[model samples]
Target: MMTFWYIFVMAGVTYLIRMIPFSFFTKRIKSVMLRSFLYYIPYAVLAAMTIPAIFYSTGHFLTALGGTIVALVLAYFRLPLIVVALAASGSAFLLSFFV
Candidate 1:
């Protein structure tokens, strides 16, 4: 159907948009500020993506939010990423079960 074609075209455009930046900058740039920004992009993106989820989790939002705060503190103390994730997820799960 026409909708399928539309989705395919949109997906292709999105892929190109994401790929073009990396392809264009692979060898021509070497700025320290740019590198630092790139290094933090994932964290910035993760926060942007996850913050809303914490606030919007409906029945268990508060517990999840608390867990996220604890995980953040652990991360600040240099805990491993996996441990932070597990702790946060476990907290959220336990709280959801209780509440």
Candidate 2:
């Protein structure tokens, strides 16, 4: 019962955190600086969350590093997201066999 209540509360809090932005920010943001900052926040947060996990994700740090480099290169070249993800995991998978 306690766990169920906690989950319900958390779900509501998460919903409001995401909902408030779309409900309120109906118009395009007028500030160039603020808009640019907002555009980059997702990427920054993604890096913050994923980078540490990348180092410890596999048996070898080098394998994960190789995969990250492959993913970054593909992303820089503007490849599709699916291709980048597949190539990254494939690179890691192949390299793991060797190491």
Candidate 3:
């Protein structure tokens, strides 16, 4: 069927797209900036993923906002990542339960 062919072609294209980057990069030399960027990319990605969730959970702005501030401070103080996450999530949960 046409659908089967379409799926096959799409799968091939997706695999090639995913593989090409590894193939290209594995053969190349790395630069200092690239190393630094790679090191910070996870933090940047974590912030990008978490920040919006902190501000907009359950349609309640203030509770989430307050928790976010607390989490930021905990993180700034160099608390463990798990502790920071737990503090933020626990604060948000308590606030939601009470307010």
Best by TM-score: 2
Please provide, for model 2 over 1-99, each residue's C-alpha lDDT reduced to its tens digit, 9 standing for 90 to 100.
Answer: 999999999999999999999799899889999999999999999999997898778768989999999999999999999999999989999999888
Candidates in order have lDDT scores of: 0.82, 0.92, 0.85
TM-score, cand. 2: 0.77
Better of 1 and 3 by lDDT: 3
In candidate 1, where is summed lDDT lowest over 10 consecutive residues? 53-62
- RMSD of candidate 1 to the true fold? 2.8
What ranking of all candidate models by TM-score puts the best one first? 2, 1, 3
Q: Which of the predicted structures, 2 or 3, would earn the higher TM-score when compared with the native? A: 2
- What does candidate 3 score in Cα RMSD to the true structure? 4.0
What would you estimate as the lDDT of candidate 3?
0.85
lDDT of 1 by residue, 6-91 (tens): 99999999999999996886584489998899899999998898877776664566787878787889889999999998887788
- The residue ranges of model 2 lying beyond 4 angstroms of the native Cα positions read none
TM-score of each: 0.68, 0.77, 0.59
Model 3 per-residue lDDT at 54? 58
> Which pairs of residues have clashing backbones in candidate 2?
none
* Superposition error at 99 for model 3 (Å): 2.2
Pull out the clashing pairs in model 1: none
Q: How large is the C-alpha RMSD of every model relative to the true structure?
A: 2.8, 2.1, 4.0
